[model samples]
Target: MKRYPIRAAKYAVYLIILFFILFALLRAFGSASPMSVLWTTSRGLMFLGVVVVFALLYPFFGFTRKRLTFNAAERADDVERIMAMCGFKRIGSENRPADDMLFEAASTAKKVAMMWEDQVRITTDADGVSFIEGNRKEVVRAAFRMGTYIA
Candidate 1:
């Protein structure tokens, strides 16, 4: 079986907090017209919060990490360029065939979260380049910081 990065309790807590956030939104703004909802609704605001906060805080909490591994398609230090674009620095590289890349970054990439390490596993395929952290779910914020979120 594939091992999950987070424990069950943590997932439960994360879900509970998400529900609470939605509930709070419901309480704060539940009486909107259908037209306004079509344009932009309270639910949209909640979604924005979900993406911004989760991306900013997940690394701060040390919930996920990344590693660097290169395939035959990659050139030397290409991984470093990718990570740098994403606001990470190549701290240590093992030069091994597996998990040979290492990076360090701050949470929210604002120079905060010194206690946390922004580890990123650089995965590039024919589809596009990707950064996978703790789980299969794509955390876009943690990817290479494109403009606002991870691209």
Candidate 2:
């Protein structure tokens, strides 16, 4: 999976704010005998709290923007390349196996190709099948491969 730098920065900013708030609360409520002790404790607590918050929120904000040259579209192309590596071809664009044949192949062979109107999905032993969604071809391909055929 790709990492989004902007989201990471946002998370950093959130942590900073959280740290300050925690530090302030500690200073406001704790003993005032030793300033150094208070500062050190507050800093430690702030760092630990921020780490915990980041861990809790990572999955939700992790994949917003990738710092890669490849955008979602390029990622889709990569997915297509992977499918080709798996002996899967574009449904109408390539000399692909027939629908029934592909289905049977998927059922019996260790690998299979699944095609949908908007996507192409593939499964192989080396690279397990994945479902992709959204405007990316990879997502679409994944969706096709993993999607259940609905009458």
Q: Each candidate: what lDDT?
A: 0.45, 0.39
Best by TM-score: 1
Candidate 2 ranges beyond 4 A from true positions: 1-3, 31-151
Model 1 — which ten-residue stretch has the worst lDDT?
Answer: 142-151
Give the candidate number with the greatest lDDT. 1
Cα lDDT of model 2 by residue, 1-151, tens digit: 3333444555566666765677677779883334455347876667667675785566354322111222223244454444454344444424442211121112223222121212233323223322222224334433343232210
TM-score of each: 0.38, 0.27
Report the Cα lDDT for residue 20, model 1: 64
- Candidate 1 residue lDDT tens string, 53-137: 5644554444444432324125435545555665666554555332344556734643333323335455545543343563222
lDDT of 1 at 68: 24
Query: Which residue window of length 10 is worst by lDDT in model 2?
Result: 97-106
